[model samples]
Target chain A: MNTTRRSFLKLMGVSAVGLSLGQLGFDLAEAQAYASKLKIEGAKEVGSVCPFCSVCCQIIAYVRNGKLVSTEGDPDFPVNEGALCAKGAALFSMYTNPHRLTKPLYRAPFSDKWVEKDWDWTLNQIARRVKDTRDKDMVLKNEKGQTVNRVDTLFMMGTSHASNEECAVIHQAIRSLGMVQMDHQARV
Target chain B: MPKAFLVDTTRCTACRGCQLACKEWHDLPANATKQRGSHQNPPDLNPNNLKIVRFNERMTKEGVVVWNFFPDQCRHCITPVCVDVADMAVPGAMIKDKKTGAVLATEKSAKLSPADAKAVAEACPYNIPRIDPKTKRITKCDMCFDRVSAGMQPICVKTCPTGTMVFGEREEVLAVAQKRLAFAKERFPKAHLVDMEDVSVIYLLAEEKEHYYEYAGFM
Candidate 1:
């Protein structure tokens, strides 16, 4: 009778695990495949690239209700396949950060604070400045009397945010203006 | 089957991708931070941040500088003592999900008195649970149950760049952890899995447990 009772207790212990059956010898709780609605479930998968470095790992931006909801490294991309560094992982917050500037801000030469400027005003001002600098610093003739048309004072610093095609256009436009000094700031 | 994590600390580069990924997945808000003279930011876990990578650097007995990175989170115990302690105060306040081996503190946790709430947090061996002063809700990692149940890996495991944080079925992950442990044993004679029998998440430490964190393993 004691043997029967002990055997029943053992059976009860075995039956105590959750509804699902699992492999023996591990603390695997019987988990059912519950389908929780994904946060980005219905969001459109828009492909893009990480704007932080030249590696430019592919990213899929999740857009829901016409707003960017999330971003993750694209699994399909061979480079950095579904893996991201701290900066790359923080792409979502970079877009949603309250400190992010949504408009152009202009500061006067001697001004202590920045004032908001319209895009038209900002672009026109930039064009005028670039033209003025190019005209003032244009060196047409070298020491050897060579026709080396280049700007000596204008330095064109490029952004990592520009795409490959955009970078090519930027290079063409700057070269046409006879600017020689150029640099990029992509790290890692 | 219950999911598990095999965290190999030796492989972790401490890029904090897991930390950021958790925040992104949960839609947790950012906390204000200052230069605390360490890479361990926000210092401790709060409602806003469920997971954090703890950085510790100190000299060993041999005068060797040892820098350790611990991606800290709640180790949902096999038989959770917190759930029992919480059940006495508010019945539905804290529950252990039988389906997923997930310990979750529900909205009813707000009903728990301040003393009871503090008691629950204090009961955790790993010192993981935190009671929000404003909400009175006992907050910690819920094993990322929502994502795991939906056939998706927890954000931390998915975003890890160095292949440090691995998540999968309990038996499979245990095998992985043991195999890695065998490899680690060659270099680190003292390397072992931390509280593997009692917790869902297992950390494979390269050296003594105290070197990583004082509460890294439960005796």
Candidate 2:
């Protein structure tokens, strides 16, 4: 009877579709085929710092064949001692998030939408704007006749995420531009 | 000896490091979230979120609003009615690890019918189990069995900056829980440890359990 049923199924071309009793039901074969692979199995660990706060918690970023696979707090770091806050723990997501901007986005005044600009164009546009703004709003001296070579229009916003060296470099650059309204995101 | 955890809610500042670390160690994906006028995001635990910090607010007798945060997860009950229920429906569906007292859902749990899985979920007093629609498997906190077996603490406990959560041998953890309970009671007068005798994970609540979360403890 089994042979006859098999022959009948063969004649009807149902066997071609793998419609046998054991095969007809739910098949985990497809799912299991992709289950053995690990997302970060062979990744290399690169030490870095969490760019969120002053703690500067060290983190280990796992890279697989030049691509970042994951990140976590470094257990060896004494400051955080393998712990991270909400913002620090989200470093992986911050890098791999779909909302992250790959290129610079520029939104002009009174513009409703942002336009993507290349690195060269963005840098040149920024330089042109900074030069024009400083040239237009330069305040070399106050009413009290103090030598305050400051640009009131151009506000330099510093990032809390910057390292000490990076902050120093940024401070020198901004100071060279004679921009006095310097503020850090930590205060905000 | 079995292992246990003592989560002192009083020391928890709602930093949510434990919650994120659990997700990171588990390799769980991010949840789409929106502002709910509260710090608690994604609302509640789903298939991806094994742990969550629940926020609750209440008025004191003096008419002052008191905000409370409860880091909620599986209690790993000693009796574990969910295990019994799951076993009756699908053998080997759920198993309690003898070494760590971790109630874990094995891979064989995929064989459980939806009704049986729902039954097991309902049997849980803490509402810890969540079914994944894509995989048709129920998942929750496993107490990091792989890490624990390798002599490492659970990721959530290791990543807790506030030292609110602690994991150790069952007896040692219970002793710590009792000590903290005594210290807390001296100050709050209403401090209590939730289900300390019945579960592997004991939570020390400063006020009533209701002020922390609805299912903070089993009565």
Candidate 3:
């Protein structure tokens, strides 16, 4: 289901109207501090899925000015019912952490230092290396003379961050190259 | 009506979702931690971490190992001693949001002397409230006032997959706590609510408070 920013704000407005303040007999002086607006008040809600594990909890990403500001479990998603585990709860940090890599880093076979590389160069290098490795390691037959189309040395490590469609495409691409050694970060 | 939190520890699995979710909402920095031979990282609550899942392990007399997970945070007491102490030093340093019963440390808290901040922290029965050495701002859980004010659940309660944390009006939350206590009593005879009358954040312990944490209850 799609949730437009206007519709989401309308829903929030209803809940906000139900809340009342300043009846607990305490000094009303702090009311000014409490009146500050919510951080995600006007942010747009974009639905996404958690990439941590098989749970695949749905999350609502709050976007403000085209930038992701916050994230929380989607309340309408029945599977999680707006709940998330520790790994899933840290989804927001995954975007904001300074340690996260923004650009690709490459290192030569014997070089100890990693140099930053652009996406175009990184993609071209990866394609070149894969073709070279597959050409060198492709095996047509086993010792028993059985026909087996496989690349014994070219291994592909899959990531959970890849979507289902991306994974399908990746699987097909690798299989066509006769790459047999495959693993996923989520499972191992 | 004032708000309250009912944390049923019996249902907690120590996933620390609440701890991490709280940090994510506050945008707090990560702490440098080393292997402490346990899952409890960073040792204790610092300015960066206002909430933490405390792990306590003990060997029973019958040679059984008992592990208890206590998700700890500021209790937001009904009559907060921290507020009193903080106010004595700086008038608007610490105040309570009457609508939610959330004890908040204001920016004025930074005006407090280091000694006065320590006194405020010491006054808390739950040993919450941390003093940031850099900003000198006394910090602790504010019950996610920004969210609660918008008629939303606190991030910690909303992220708990175990349904261990329930937030709502005080009376309704107390009823839920009592019902949970009744269910808990069937399996763990010592199960009881922790200082429900004194604090907005209530905990239902399956065993004695000592098995949970040293300051699990005001005692």
Candidate 4:
């Protein structure tokens, strides 16, 4: 048999263990039980918030050596009181999802593809567009000749994941831009 | 004292918080799902799901459309047939925890051959066990053995906001179940506890067992 170096190592490794335990077959039952015990044992926990909806349920993220081992509802949270809806329960998958974007993605108008952009570049682009839209579409007066400092070009959509303080800051920022059209995922 | 669960179907709005909380506590992964025209996702229980709220709609005798929500899970049988059958195949495959009266599927169950696992699965009156093909392991609810051992209620029972699910000492739970049954019977004449004597997880159904689910009881 023409065994490659990798195959030779595997063969030697298998035989070495097999030879150590002469007649007895693998103690697979013991191994399986051991595996289950290894799962939840000796794990540290970190506190986090479920980012799905307005409930903002608190969660305890179990970590083993900086890796997230599991997540569960935080019993101490007053709002959810350790209860989590389907969306809130799926927080672990949402965080560990392979499709989760690690960088800001931008797509030009009418473009079908998204291109990754750095934080500075993305921020600068957003600032430039907001300034241009505010300058171009700023409404100074209505038909009644009343002073209405509003911008119609930009619409602000807020996230349900935002905390109370974060939402306040976002509301203030949008108002400063004279943007009247505002909505949030919380109501949905 | 045996632990009991009171699952009041009438109070269940089917928010599926119990379902999600069970999955989170067990650290199971998400299953691929599609819109199946019902709020029930993934259709039925798999390795990833230990609890599911089944949605069923039917017309009453008066010709009014009625929708019913059945939150289904392992009943944790008092004398679990699955435990007896699994023990016959593999001595420690399934064990009835003496402390909490939880019928737990030990990791040793993975050693049971496919045919043996099938026999154990079939032994369940509720058809609760699902064998994971990839891992070749039999999986089902363990009644949160770890949590219960550490003086915490099962995650599903703790997370039920509607009080549809409850867990406590077996005697205490039965008392609560009896009290709720008496209250429920006033409104729902058909209200009764399904297989209350045989199972640790007692379900207080407001309708006939068939109206809840096919295996809601063991005939």
- The lDDT of each candidate is 0.82, 0.81, 0.88, 0.79
Models sorted by TM-score, best on top: 3, 1, 4, 2
Q: Candidate 1 vs candidate 4: which has greater TM-score?
A: 1
Per-residue lDDT for B171-210 in model 2, tens only? 9998898899999898889999998889999999998887
Candidate 1 iRMSD in angstroms: 10.2
TM-score of each: 0.86, 0.81, 0.87, 0.83
For candidate 3, please provide the TM-score of chain A on its own.
0.79
In the range B1-219, model 4's lDDT, one tens digit per residue, is: 556777888788888988887887777888989998988887988999988998888899999987889889998988999889988888878877655677777777888999999999998999899898888888888787655544457878877777888898988888888899999999999999888888888888888888777777885
lDDT by residue for model 3 over B105-143, one digit each (tens)?
A: 987898999899999999888899999999999989989
Query: In CAPRI terms, where does candidate 2 land?
Result: incorrect
Docking class of 1: incorrect
* Candidate 3: clashing pairs of residues: none
Return the interface RMSD of the candidates, in order shown, one decimal each: 10.2, 15.1, 3.0, 12.0
Relative to the unseen true structure, what is the C-alpha lDDT of residue A125 in candidate 3, on a scale of 0 to 100?
Answer: 95
lDDT of 2 at A169: 96
Name the top DockQ candidate.
3
The per-residue C-alpha lDDT of model 4 at residue B160 equals: 79
Please report how far candidate 3 places residue B179 from its true position, in Å.
2.5
The predictions' CA RMSDs to the true structure, in order, are: 9.4, 12.5, 3.3, 10.9
Model 3 DockQ, alpha carbons vs. true complex: 0.48
The residue pairs that clash in candidate 4, if any, are B2-B170
TM-score of 4: 0.83
The DockQ of each candidate is 0.22, 0.14, 0.48, 0.17
State which candidate, 1 or 2, has the greater lDDT.
1
